[model samples]
Target: MTTETAGGPTGPAARPAPHRVVIVGGGVTGLVAARQILRDRPETTVTVLEASERLGGQVLAIDVDGVAVDVGAEAIHLGAPAAADLARALGLDATVIAARRGQSVLLTRRGLRPLPAGVGPTGPTRVGPVLRSGILSWHAIVRAGLEPLTRRRQAADVAVGDFVQGRFGREVTDTFVDPLLGNLHSGDIHRLSLQATAKQLVPVAESGTSLLLRALRKPTPPPRRPDEPAPLPMFASWPGGLGALVDALASSLEGHATVRTAVRVEAIGRTGDTWRVDTGEGPVEADAVVVAVGPRPAAVLLGPHSPATARALEAVDTASVATVVLAYEREAAEQNPVLRDANGLLLNSSQSGVLKAMTNMSRKWPLGHPSWHIVRVSVGRAGSRVAVDLSDAQMIAAASGELATLIGLNATPVFATVVRWPDAMPQLTVGHPGRMAAARAELAGIPGLHLAGSAADGLGLTSTIASGVQVARTLVG
Candidate 1:
């Protein structure tokens, strides 16, 4: 239908109002989504609903005797594009701090041994360094040397521990990988999924390629500009700690978003073309909704409408772990030879128990005062409930005693604190990602409903934040 001149069309139709997107949960995933939605869909009205009073979730910080330290997540790979881009946009480029140079030692049957170069959580990238380090026996080293001839067992998915064991042997997996990766995920190595945990390795596992060779062909970072401060390390954290990242995200969301805290979302359902997010007070409606909470809470919300999704979420299990921080006099701690150049120390499960690893926080990061040396002692893992029942005082004492025994830290700590995370880490077991994908694909049939977070994408800051960013783009389209 052709219309006339300056008056425009004969009959004008009013355009619809801007879209409304409701984000559930207030953790890193939810917060990232909220900021992203506001950025991508500038006209869209955004509201973030948080179940708890805290908005950052695991990105938390606390002051221990005048020193600010992360009680939750501590650092991130600032060199990675996603983190770098986000930090640049947030005006945090100048404030990033690198992990100070040091070495990590492994507590093996032969006692404390320096971790060989080119070694990772799974296995050594080069056999030469490991052969000399003696973390494994002569016989085990010989077995690993035969990795090029190892039989290929291709599958769609496999356990990380099994993959390492097939290429190396049980001794390598138990002595090295189990202590490193196990503590990282707070789950068992044999149960963690290779596909979900490390997607890049899935292709290598399926191709039966030599992981050692592939690991060697690592990607190189772009050359740094001369004006840039120093080459940004692989990881960096703010002087305020990791919590600063969360605070910056929240700050950016101001004026563009309506963030509500301590407001519990009881359930979510579709009514007509909009979604109804029911809170204790009333219902908040929106055109689209993102469920970025953990698995258990997510299950509770999706149970009524999408039973399959609820079941899939319910099936995903989690393990509990704790972080205990202890501070000591700089002179006292540095007296021990290990504390001078130690970034951290890892102990096998079979070794003198309770504590599995310890991070020399003062040496690792320069945020604290030089007069005091701080250390973070990590305890608990999958299938072990030792940390679950221990009282805070008991945990502090036990960790302090372990430090004294391990490094000759005979002097009493100046200050100490313990923080417990109960069932906080999600277990991405074998076949879990496929199960989640199928559920999400099925959920696609329902309009205006989506999932994004550690529960859906697995743990780690990179994966969780990436999931939220993807969800934002989906909503915009």
Candidate 2:
């Protein structure tokens, strides 16, 4: 609408309305973004609209027999300090607890064995670990060791499988990289991007000579002295599961921002330099808007006005996944050595049939449960249809059957609960980094429009939180 002057209606005048931001999703990312925006621009108005009745998105928890069980992400990766910093700042540090043990075994043809010391999410880093574990045959080991002789890959972007297999052999890719990187993204390594997903290997990938040679030349740190403070744990979580984090983040925004649940944003369009956010209830006019939902939802909202932006978002791939939390009889669990200490098992490519990985929550957080031996089982992966048709009962049965075969736990679980997330796990395919960059570059042309979520740049709590902080700073600064 044009502003009316003394003589006649003037062309679209300056924005006289108070500066307000309409956040399109109420998940952790959106809420965190809202929190940061309010902190930076104290005078600006912020509105958080969530489609679901509950917040937290994938970071959720459910009650089973009166005990809160995390059906989604349970651990907070401490490699980055975004989550830890946010938790501490929100007074959630006291509730945080470190893993009692982190020793995880790999499912091999020989049986479950300790993972190679130097093996990571990308691929093998040291030969000694693979040699000791005997997970690789001598032929594959020699092939992997000779990777220094292979020519550097010429592609600007390559598949993670190709990069790892080129540096290591195919066997190593299947045995080592599959479970860590593949299962992590719920995607196939052959399709997942090396540059986008595996950042640690880029230096070695670009080196053109040898991953092992470079790994061997790395310096080792000296032992810590008694007076030195302890480094942060690799992973941590509150006793209340990740839901505590969601609760804390939501509470931090109380009175600082307007948070509304069950409010779905239908479309976003520009009206004379102002954003008109059409929602289920009514329209919300704001100075800026942040689309923090998954790419699918974001695509639906952005398609009407910004087709290019919407298509860029819609092109992103996602996989459906389900989590099954099973409680077993204490006596049966105590007898099983696998449940005694350490984390659960990571299924290699051969064993990636019905289960992805299982977490032994009883010992991972031993203090939380003394009576029940609880296990959290992850199912589904990109391009896999095994879990698509399974119901809650079927999922539980499959999870139990696998646990029995893997750990010799024949006893039935005392309780079980299933949580399914459809098209939730985002896949970073080859050229994904470039696609994201192009999408962002295109988004920059459109003022007051921003994208921030796991779907935006990365997955997991740390990356999502970092994206939120970045989008907020960019919007408010």
Candidate 3:
């Protein structure tokens, strides 16, 4: 909402206002940092420069045929302190509801089958349902039972795929975890750090107990505040969609924030005490600069300033991902078995020929409602042999075909939307934390320079928000 020259709020022709702090990247991280900086230090001038004209990076939402289609992140996994704090700060009206975890279908060679209870993303949390389910062979179940007897390999961290395949057998990893947790990371399980990705179940794997017993006896710490309610499915987007959160944060800055679109940051270099940021238009000098882009971009920008940081960032590989949004008539799709669907079913990459997973947006969130009868299908992995290669229309056709087989549907969708994110989700390899620590230490010497993004921490809205808030605290402190 504010416009100013490189001279900033104060120039020789005008009275000086405050210290100028430039925030690069206008995604959630940059916007959050701008808000935090303005709130913490009113004397400081905050500006957000985004390469894209639109903000909210991955938390993007669009209206298609009078229906709200979330092209990016649909769910908010923020629990407790983060969610409550953010909701209050933004004055966002959020509805508390649990994610549709039950009434899911598991696609198999036979047909769409009811998802067996106790078979979580990690493994069977309870043994009864798993034993009864015909999904796994008897031999595979016996192999799973031997997990407690298996020795915990002494390593800093291992790939989730390796660990699961070694302990539970390849069938479990491919059949269940691959489609469930694997899809969560866009199906780059081999590269995904077990420490960062499947940390909740790490202790169970480490303990000399079967996953079922471990899950049952897992010592979950009681809430510090008993009166506070458990977060409802982490948190969902407000009525207007996730974009509402971004718009609210941007508006809160008022005239303080300056968002530059269609301007690519060519390079970032250190100039004595201050850092110089090079853009397509020109260079902007600032006392502080936050590189909040993806890891690959961060590596490119920080190469001159901090080679170690750059290399460290480069160590974290990124995977390309695609999200396909398809719409169908509700009554027409009712005949499909999977379509009796409570929400949507998550498909394992190995089982489903085309899709990694799918979400029934209309059933899950209020934005789409039932009229749209929307479904979101994910495709691709961080790195894998087999891959899905199809244009928007082709991808939709493939997904529709799968739907037809799974649910017995023959009707065509009105229209479909596809969002491709190239090198978006970062693959946090083993020893990721250590590598990040070393990079941070190297960059610590440089004053007025900070790092914040999905690449900095674990990929998620909650983590990205925390990175921005933490960087702001570091600066103010």
Pairs with steric clashes in candidate 1: none
Q: Compared with the true structure, what per-residue lDDT tens digits does model 3 show for residues 1-477? A: 333332123112122356678888888888788777766665676777888878888888777787667778887765646655775556553444445555567665445666677666665677677677787887888887777676474353778778887777877787777777777777567767777677665675565346645656768777659776445455466665677777777777777567776777889877687778899889988888888889888888886778778877988877787888888887776556566565677676656666767777766666545565778877777674223356777777777777666666778887687888777788887878778888888888888878888787777787788788888777765
Q: What residue runs in model 1 are displaced by over 4 Å at the alpha carbon?
A: 1-17, 151-153, 215-231
Higher-ranked by lDDT: 2 or 3: 2
TM-score of each: 0.91, 0.91, 0.86
| Per-prediction backbone clash count | 0, 0, 2
Q: What lDDT would candidate 1 get against the real structure?
A: 0.79
Ranking by TM-score: 1, 2, 3
lDDT of 1 by residue, 322-421 (tens): 8999888989888876677888888766674778889888888885675888888988877778679999998899988997888777688888889988
All predictions: root-mean-square deviation over Cα?
6.1, 7.0, 5.4
lDDT of 3: 0.72
Which is the winner by lDDT between candidate 1 and candidate 3?
1
- For each candidate in the order shown, give its overall lDDT on alpha carbons: 0.79, 0.79, 0.72
- Assess the local accuracy of residue 207 in candidate 1 as a C-alpha lDDT between 0 and 100: 81
| Candidate 3 residue pairs in clash (backbone atoms < 3 Å) | 179-348, 336-407
